[model samples]
Every structure is written in C-alpha cells, then in structure tokens.
Target: MNPMTIHVKQQKHDLALAPSRVVFYEQMQLVETFDDQSQCHMLFFYKQKYLTAVRTTRLKLHSYVACAFKEGTVYESPHPFLQALIETNIPLQKYSYPQLKKKIARPYSRQEQAKILTFFESFIPKKQLFQDMKSLFYQYRREGNMSAAYRVIRVMRDFAPNNRFVKEMANDLSYRKLANLYLEESQTLMERDPLFKEMCASFEDHQRLLEKEGRWIEAYTHQLSHISNQPTSESYQSYRASLSRHFDSDSRTYILEELSQAIPSFQPVTEDLFHNHVVNENVNAVARLYTERELNLNEEQFKQVEALLEENRFNETPENLLPFMKRITAQHPDQTRKLLDAFVIRLLETMELEQVHDFLKAFKKKSSLMRKVERMNEIHEDLDCMQELGELYYGFHQLEKSIECFQMEMELKPSAPEPLRWLSKVYADKKMLDESKAYQQLCVDVQKWA
Candidate 1:
C-alpha cells in the first residue's frame, strides 16, 4: 500500500479572507476533517466516527495508537492499543521512530531527519501548546481570517478557560463575522467550562439573542452555573437580581429547584440551598442537609439551625437534631446542652458506650451533663459500668462525682480492686492527700490478699 498523503490546500486568492483547509488522503480518498492543524495523524473513518492513528513514543513496542479528538479532549477506546490498530483501515505496525543519538553517526538522509524532527516535536507540553495557540490566534487576527482566528481562540480558551485575555479574544470574535460561530462554539464549550460559560452569558449580544429566541432557561442555567462555580457574594446577588428582574415567582421557584439539584456537585450551591431551606424553616430539608455532611455554617446560619431545632423539638429524634445542636454549642449553649442531654440519654438506652463518650468528651462538663450521666449510672448499675463511669467523671475533673461512682462500685463488689485505685487517683486530683493515702492503702491490701 502507498503511504498516506497529508497536506493543506490554501485558496489561491484573498489569503486573508480564505481559510486554510487541511486534507488527508489514503490511496487518493479523503478520510475526515480536522479544525486544528497541529496534530500529526493517519486519518481514517470507521464505525461512523472519524478516528486518527497518532504516533505515540510512550508505548514499549507499539509505534502508534488510534484515538479520536473532540473539543480539545482525547477519546481513546478501552480496547488494547494493538487491537485498535488491527481494526483500523491503515496498518501502522512498522512506523517506529529511529533510535535517538546525541551525536550524528553519519550524514543522515532528509527523510530520516524529517522523521526525527517530527518525532521530537510530536508531544507538545500543555503550557507550550497554550502559548503557541495564543500566538496563532494573534496571527490569524492580523490576517483578518476570523474563521481561522476563532478556531485558534477556541483551542486557546480550552487551554486557559479562565484566562482574561482568552475571554477578551472570545468577546472580540463575537462582534465580527464569526458571531454565530462564537455563540455556537460557546454553547458547546459552556457545557464543560463554567468560567467560559459565565463569560458567554455576560455578553450583551449573547444574552439578548438567547432571550429573544425564548431560550431563557439556557440563560438562567448559565447564570446558575456561574454562581455554582464562583459562589461569591457579588455573583449570588447578581443572580438574585437577575431572577427578580426577569422571572416571575413560579419561574424563580423552578430555577431554585434546578439550583437544589446542583448541590451534590457544587457545595457552594448546597450552602445556598441550605440557606434558603433554613430561611423557609423547612424542617425536612434542613434535617436532610444535616445528615448529608458536616456543613460549615456561619453564625447567622447556626442561629437559624438552632431555631429550627427548637421549633421541631417535639417531633425530631435526638439523633436527627444532635449535629445542628453540636455545631451551635458556642452560640446557644443552653439549647445545645438540652439536645445533647436527650442524645446522651438515647445512647445510654442503647448502651453505645463509644458514642456516648464521644459526645460527653466533646463539651465541658455542665451541671446538666452531670445529671445526664447520672442516668447512665441508672441504666447500667453493674460493677464494670460503675467503674467505667467513675473513670469518665475523673477525666472531666468531676472529682466528687468520680469518688461517688467509685464508692458505689466498691459497695456493689467489695472484692474488686479497680474502683479503689480510681478513688485514690480521684481524691489525689481533688488535693485530698489523706483520702488518697487511705484508698491507696486499701488497694494495696486487696492486691496483697489476691
């Protein structure tokens, strides 16, 4: 089979106005079209998609792999690279790069030098590609080839979607002959690029045309996506203002529903959704948000959650209310303790020792908390539970309560030495030297008997 020929066919007249078109032919038949001119490939059509066999030096034995490029992203099949070649129209099994040398062994042929040059230049670094695309964009603009200029800018936009200059270039192109092309490309790119999408929506022409065409949902989506991506106060205020200016109450509600759906992917959106739900005092939504994740709520939001917990106190479970209660502990100490009191009681009923200890250890021991742990003594009155509760109180520096628990445990099992040792430690912590010595001696006597 003859080698495939790849070349560009430039129009003879009006170089600035005409586009440079690249054509690929295998045995004198055109395969497919490519917008970017920098890619090296042996092109072919198979399975109703245009595929290119690109040279890859990364592979150990293989010279090339088949892949398809779309919108600046590469798509390669999961089939083994070798298997993809077998399915392709052209075979690239023998097209490997020559061994690289630091110094020339002999004068090389032109074909060998060209192959080496292409090999070295095949994989362009992302930063370098971005720079080259920007340079090409300016070159195309200087020649008044807006079609070619926009194509280069599109790739540039992909490289640096949030770049100010790239965005300006896009805006400049939107005013020229490529206005429709700019809008069309933006519509495609906006699906993936939030910053670019935000830029497109910011354009007056794009906004006016979109609304004029009864595509307000798309416009709303662009704004919502912008807020989701940015989530700054200014962006959110602008979104709210836009909603008030353009949308009715029903439309606003629908847009809010759309915003709520985006919560899982964009946490900032979740923050907004949570704010709205708290403002409306939607107990179920607020409760679900608590269960979803640990939210970083502000002071005002924490107050709102506190109010919600207070309002729903009659019906909600301690498990459902504890997270919000725990978060607002500093702001609403009384309310947090009240809910935690109930939560501790629930854990005691289940005898979930670890969970109960976690809650108790999280906060400083309040008078109400001591009363709550008394219920734990009421629930589990065995010698072991008494010894455990004694240590728990000792950890909180409640020395009197610790001694009380240790005395009760000693009464329940006079032979047990554990509570005697704990009583000694607790009394010493209270700076009661005489009591510490008494209990320490009792522990020694019990161990000696054993």
Candidate 2:
C-alpha cells in the first residue's frame, strides 16, 4: 500500500442531510502525486438542493469524515487527522503539495470492481425495508462481514428514508471496504427462516412474474387466493386491483362471478361489486345490470341528482354516481329513468369525436354510458334514446349502424321524418343513389303526412 497520504480515495455520494439546504457527501479518498506532497484531508461536503449558499460545504482541501460530540448547537468531529492538525496546530505554510493524483484500486481484479459496482446498485424502495436492511448492515459491519454489509448498505443508499442516512451509510459502505469483503451465507437464526424468503417475495414481485409470463388471469387468481386466506378489506381491494389490471369488464365479470360463486362470502365484500366494478367500466355490462338491486340513494335524491347533473357534469367524480343512481332507480323508477337518461345524454352529447376519431366509440364501448340510456327506454318505454343515438351515429359517420338505430327508432315512433332523413344521408354516403333518393322523397312525404 502507498504510504498514508493523510486521505483516502473518495467519490461523491449525493445525499441530503435536510431538505435541499442541508446536504451531505461521501466516498472519502486520498491521492498521492509525483510532483510534490501536501496534506490532503478533505472528503465530503453538503449543499442543499439548487440554492446558492455562501457557506456551503463543498468537498475541498478542508473536508472531513467525522465522529464528534457537540458543545452547543454546532457539531464537532473526532476524526484522527482532524484531531492531529487541531492538537498540533499545524501551519498551512509547512504543508507540502503533490503532483499526480494517487490512483486507488488499480491492483484489484475486475470481479472486485464489479462487487463495488453492485454495492452502488442495491436499493430498497420501502423505507421500513431499508431501515431493517441498515440494521442488518450494521450487525455485519460490526462483525467485519464486509460482503453482507455491502449488500445492506447498497440497498440503503438506494432507498434510505433521508439523504443524511445515505451519507452516513456511504462512509461505512465505502468501495474501499467492499474490496476486502467476500460473499457468504447468513449465520443469524432469524435470517435462516425459509418462510422469510417466501414472505420477502412481495405481491409486486409475483405480479411482475405473472405479467411477464402473460398470465394476468393467474395474477388475478393469486390475489383471489390471497384474499381467501386474509379476508380483509385491503385484501379484497388488492383483488379488485388485480381484476382491473388483468381483465376487461367482460372477463372481470366472468372471473368475479366465478369467484363469487366459489367463495360465497366474496359477494358481500363490496356491497355493489357489479355496479362498482362492472357497470362503471363496461357500457354493455351496465345495460345488463338493470335487473340487479340498488344499494343507497332514496327517491328524494333523484331531484338532487338531476339538479347536480344539470349544475356540473359528472365528468370527473369519485363518488359512486352509477350505483347511487341504481339506488334511486330502486325507489323511483320513472324519475330515475328520466334522470339517468339525461345523465347518459349529457355524457353522449359531449362524447363528440375529438382528435381521435374513435374517442367516442371507445368511450361508448368502455363505460356503457349509452347502454344506461338504452336501459331507460326499457324501463319507461318513453325516452326514445334510440333516436338521439341514431343522430349521434350519423354524426360519427357510422352509416349502417345509424340506419339500424333509426330503423329501430322508427318502429317505436312511426311517421318520424328524423329517421327517414338520416337513412337518406347514409344511403348517399354508401353511393346507393336510388335508395338515397327514395328515402329523401319519403322524408318529405313523412313531413307532409305528419
């Protein structure tokens, strides 16, 4: 080893002690130069976030890694070189300078360099896990088990609760020390538990694997299985999340229905799982949900729902607006039908094609909001939602589908020129001149007949 040049080779371990104002540095190092020799003692410095500070501690000739006590508000370090200089009262004029920078680790193998790199790569996202890791790291550090310490410290630097913790851990987790450490098995009894490793595999880990294997259904199945054992609101929430992630409403419904039947009590976990999970996500599913029982709102709330819908659209809402309407419909079918029709209309009316031509189509297919309106016609036999829908279809240039809707509307309200007029436009678009002219003439005839 080169003679002690009063410092060690260091790198910047970007860690903040406080917010941005109080930062820390690490990787204390010493360099030997060929030209001359001077006292080199500085290591770490701190600067908060981005603000310029006059007294900011930047790594310079005076930096020091420390262990000290405080006489008052200020701290004092007990580093050996610091103590030597302070006690001896060494003058700056006597200090000699060196030429070439002393290179460290040239003698180590590539494997050693890789191990040092690995230390920097390890980090845990969970604060608690990091803290636990640090506790383990310290135990190994004290025992001079540098390999385990490297592992633990690597995780800490990545996921430490704060930057100060990082700087402190960095000093102990120095790359220099890592060269001396070698990998070995854990000796502690707690770490010896087979179940511990199994438990360490988080839901995220399992999900990642399943997703990578294109087994979303398996992930969903796993969550369902996990919920069966745990049986908590959170577990069920995870189950719901898995359902959302893996399956569309159709598949989700199928999976959920099967799960509900298999686990009799799964249905009760959320009072309105269909309305909550299925209806909101699937438009066609909402149309099918008309037969199910509602849960919360009363008849009086229908007026409020209408007033609320009129005031501001439920464009961005968190409340279970769909199920709340379901509850209202349970009480007042006629009024609820009207309000729901209006609500669905508002969404459909605004569902105009924006930049993407398929935006409205996507929305219509996804949320089943338009299906909700169709259900209103089923309940009341009054709101001719098909007429409005046909117009919407025509607006979207879905000619054949528009004609179907208009034809359906005409069956409900015969002698209506609206459908005849739309059929004419669609035929024109299809280049069926005869049929287009025929409907065009029939539109005028219907108007006169009316």
Over 360-396, each residue of candidate 2 has an lDDT whose tens digit, in order, gives 2223232344453344335323345777766666654
Estimate candidate 1's RMSD in Å: 19.4
Candidate 1 clashing pairs, residues 3+ apart or interchain? none
TM-score of 2: 0.23
Where's the lowest-lDDT run of ten residues in candidate 2?
46-55
Candidate 1 achieves a global lDDT of 0.51
Report how far off residue 194 is in candidate 2 (Å).
6.5
lDDT of each: 0.51, 0.42
Question: Which stretches in model 1 have alpha-carbon errors above 4 Å?
Answer: 1-202, 229-235, 241-272, 280-303, 314-317, 320-323, 342-358, 374-379, 383-450
Poorest 10 consecutive residues of model 1 by lDDT? Answer: 21-30
RMSD of each: 19.4, 21.9
The deviation in Å at residue 394 for candidate 1 is: 26
For residues 202-276, write the lDDT of model 1, one tens digit per residue.
Answer: 545555655664444445544565565556667666776777665554445445645656546556556766776
Q: Which stretches of candidate 2 lie over 4 Å from their true place?
A: 1-220, 242-258, 263-272, 275-284, 287-330, 337-450
